[model samples]
Target: MKYSARLRLLAVQTGLIASLGLGFATLAYSETILTVALAANPQMQTAAKLIGNFEKKYPDIKVRFQTLPENQLRPAVLKDVATKSGQYDVVMIGAYEVPLWAQKGWIVDLSQYAKADTAWNEGDLLRPIRNLVSYKGNLFATPFYGSSSFMFYRKDLFAKAGLTMPETPTWNQVAQFAAKLDDKKAGVSGICLRGVPGWGQNLASLTTVINTFGGRWFDQKWQPALSEPESKAAINFYVNLIRQHGQPDAAKDGWQECLQLFSQGHAAMWYDDTVFAGPVLDQAGPGVKDNVGFAMAPVKATKASGWLWAWGLSIPTTSKNRDAAWKLISWLTSQEYIKLAGEKAGWGQVPPGSRTSTYQIPEYKKAVASFGDLTLQSINSADPLRPTIEPVPYSGVQYVDIPEFEQIGDFTSQQISGAISGQVTVDEAINASQKKMTDIMQDAGYIK
Candidate 1:
């Protein structure tokens, strides 16, 4: 890709023109290059095609995608933007970062970019998705993939067990159903959950579980709420469930691990990101493509509960090539990308849980069957602000939207994961989380 003259000038001002030129030259022959930080996933094919098209149109500009492991992508981008390195022209981000980064003025504001580009079709994006991708009524990011939590099960096993999952199953009901379907003697575990210890990893599912069990992380006064009776009950319930029925190495399993297990017919049920359905249904990936089943996440004492997340692209304010990044971001998120994904990778492998239009498409509907509607419903029902039945000040369902939340949530999950690993008791885990959260709250001046 060819750099704009203005970009070269801006790079000179930043004393990065030499570095940028070296970076471009270092790549396979290119005078212009856009560096993108991303997370690897199956749907990236569409973006690759769009990049190919971009190179074809702007032959002078070459886009280099530096895709990281799912967990590493965000932190790498955060470091780049936070340090004002501008190493990344485009960054993959999420709901957790959109508002926070935009509010901090670390990322470029894309409101004008969206408004001026008729071809981008901001209105054509899914409503909840578009909303989650925004901060202060301005678009800061474009969703590359969005998801809500859901249940992936085995229909054949459910039928043989003479059980049917409810439209909105409860956590208790899920436990019972999983027990029935579990065939430990045959090596199948009752349920699968993410145990990977990032705040957005296990904590995503764990927070929703906490909410459904009538728990809150903080009260209106910002005091730590993890010690509440309901929260304790929730923690005990989860710790016991995993100890009693979860797969071995429960603390090591993340989305991919659970997806692999379920697809291999080792898990009776899995509670994870709805995005997992794509690989499960892909004929080339998991061998159990035809036998997979899906439903909305189980809840308790709540109308609905599911965590919302999006893997998206945001330009850092430090970027000198905002317009060029906008071009790439717009193309990646356009309706055209979805269509291309469907045509090239099959409807089942297309990105899920972001758009209303995908479900309406006959090919996609037929490819996905009943669960497509459930995925859409799950995304729509996720109310981050009203996540739990109880009132809370946070604006995220599975996540609390504070800068400190990442550290707090991850540290807290470590405490719980220790219990699941039999290194601590459930009570000890809860008490530790309570103490740490209390300290964090006090330090943040949320408590005295």
Candidate 2:
């Protein structure tokens, strides 16, 4: 009955197996794989978590993230982009790089993509943040989140000490408060600040201080000003404040270390990025969540003293997967993504300062009640174009917008960090940096 029947059945089974294998291969081949470089911050971490939703929505596109700490992320992406290596289809960059990269044609104009995608709601972005990420009105990148510097103080500690913290304390007052609140015996420092050396690390905080003290990186004439009286005063005050009453090993502390210290109740106050308010008041465990106070960035001579910044996503000109990259970017930066983040992670953890609509969400406003209004206020007040009280040729608060600033800020931060570590005096550090700046400015033709 069935030798021929058995042979026919075996052939049918073999064909079925081959058909299934071919179908799986076709699926794999059709799916687009995008390599994205991301900064290893909390929001970006949440983005990595939520990326699965994007993959689910577009089953044909797969995203692979290469996340690194802020210090490492900058150089790795810069090297790849500068060499046109095409290793990364997308990279996380800051507002500082946006204009320069756009001008150089290193990154492609994203305006067309944003224009085509009407659902993305490009106009919903905050005006200040939108301007910062654009060059000559052409968008080269989209901000994942925007931030400005502000102060965080422990209200319980302030009350216990019978001290009334002002809504906008001056730097001098902050120093006095630090002196009073500093309790070394109880394992608490008065304040926590970034001391780790990097352009975006310690220098970011220090630059704002310099600005408030009525100092500019360069005068209108483009002369070096690091060793000028106002600049020196700012540097000395910062270095002295940290050495005297800042967290121990202050020289070794960056934003992450400082956040850890403040969140662990080891510091009475912290002056840092407004983004930290979320982690401080709600997300970063239970340190001072119930007793934190929000205030404007401590001021000196200027009416305000905060720096504006944003971490953004951009496509390099060399990227082959531009469409796929833009798909990922639009998805991450859209209002829908913000809502998705608020739902999946806490509303407190949603990326902030980018969209006007983010603040309007009822849940988000409630979740960040302590800092929401003030965060928006601070971001709006920050003027990167007119960063310093005195006129200067540059247009950055935490950084300069030139390509050489990477080298300049890094070098200057190292010298100032030496002052913080006691390896060099304030005068020595400033003098060395001023000399270096003079040479750089002259060589770059900013000065004769």
Q: For this target, which candidate reaches the highest TM-score against the unseen true structure?
A: 2
Root-mean-square deviation of candidate 1: 7.9
Residues 245-359 of candidate 1 have per-residue lDDT tens digits of: 8888989887778877887878888898887777776632343566677878888878788888887889988888877888788877777777777887678767776666767
Cα-based lDDT for every prediction? 0.81, 0.90
- Residue-by-residue lDDT tens digits, candidate 2, 169-285: 999999999999999999989999999999999999999999999987888888878877898899999999999999998888998888888888999999999998886665444
List where candidate 1 sits over 4 angstroms from the true fold: 1-30, 283-287
